[model samples]
Target: MTLITDTISRAAITDSPLLATLAERWSPRAYDADAVIADDTLTTILEAARWAPSASNSQPARYIVARRGTESFTKIHDALIGFNQTWADSASVLIANVVDTTENTNPWSVYDVGQAVAHLSIQAQHDGIHTHQMGGFDAAALAQAFGLTETQTVISVIALGVLGNIDGLSPELLARESAPRTRKTLDELLLVND
Candidate 1:
């Protein structure tokens, strides 16, 4: 996978090989303000999410997408907290990932939603779009703004767009954006039975 250095200095260097899209996929706070994703591209990304596996084929994951400059987008953006509000505005698309917890209320529903979002993010990366999933948002505020029912649980807010210059970011964020990516080794991650 080609190292991404336009918006950030560091790239995702893995211990072993990985899929190009997975290796290249890294969230950036700097998003191109003027770029708008095509409808077909957005559909393709969502289509990838739509096919994610769920418990009993429940398909509990749901998405509320708000393109840039719409009322929905503004509402979603306004719900961001702290540093997220500072950079998320430049993104071309904001999505609220939610899961239905009404009937089944299965513990695995959250995992299903996470899988769906992961699929969407990887697909976006393959299509040359960057995705940043944020947990620093007001879920209740978003739910109220989006008119989500009590049964729907907000999972995350995803910011999607092309990468942009880091000049506009705060010093702290700029440092974070350019920092080397690291992950736990397999030895640390895996638990072997005696």
Candidate 2:
């Protein structure tokens, strides 16, 4: 594992035995502004998402990627809500996950898109990339900026980059970043009803 991954892993709090990559994976608001991700690396991460399972192979998930310093990136960043915009602006790459809702209304397309995004996140973690998915963006604004049709629904925006100094973040975000991770118990999540 890379030093960044090691540090994140040491800070993670996991309840079960999980793959090292999974355990190390997290959403970091502080990103290395100077870091630039390679095209090949981004392609590999997307490839992982491509292989994720879909309902009857509908394969509705699509990604609109914008590298930092580009107009597209600025558009995506501008669509973000207040707090998210403050932190996500420093990410090296921004990706908007969308789903095609043209053909079928099965509602499973959203789930498929979620799986694809999860795959992308895991692949990124394996590659020592930090990713933070945000739901605080204006979907309509993003669609307008990207020329997405009504058939396309924007699901989420992902901020991708290397970890950066916590001091770069505002005091509130820094405190949240340093806070311990927590999750509900398995019993609370899984229940058998008679």
- Taking all chains together, the TM-score of candidate 1 against the true structure is 0.94
Instruction: Give one digit per residue, the lDDT tens place, for model 2 in 14-118.
Output: 677788888888888888899999999999999999999999888999899999999999999999999999999889999999999787767699999999999
Write out the backbone clash pairs for model 2. none
Candidate 1, which ten residues in sequence have the lowest lDDT sum?
1-10
lDDT of 1 by residue, 1-194 (tens): 23345623444677888887888888899899999999999999999999989999889999999999999999999989978999999999999999988768877999999999999999999999999999999999988998889999789999999998787778798788877888888788779845
Question: For each candidate, what is the lDDT?
Answer: 0.89, 0.87
Q: State every prediction's TM-score relative to the real structure.
A: 0.94, 0.93
Say which candidate scores most in lDDT: 1
RMSD of each: 2.9, 3.0
**Clashing residue pairs in candidate 1, if any?**
none
Model 1: residues >4 Å from true position, as ranges? 1-4, 7-10
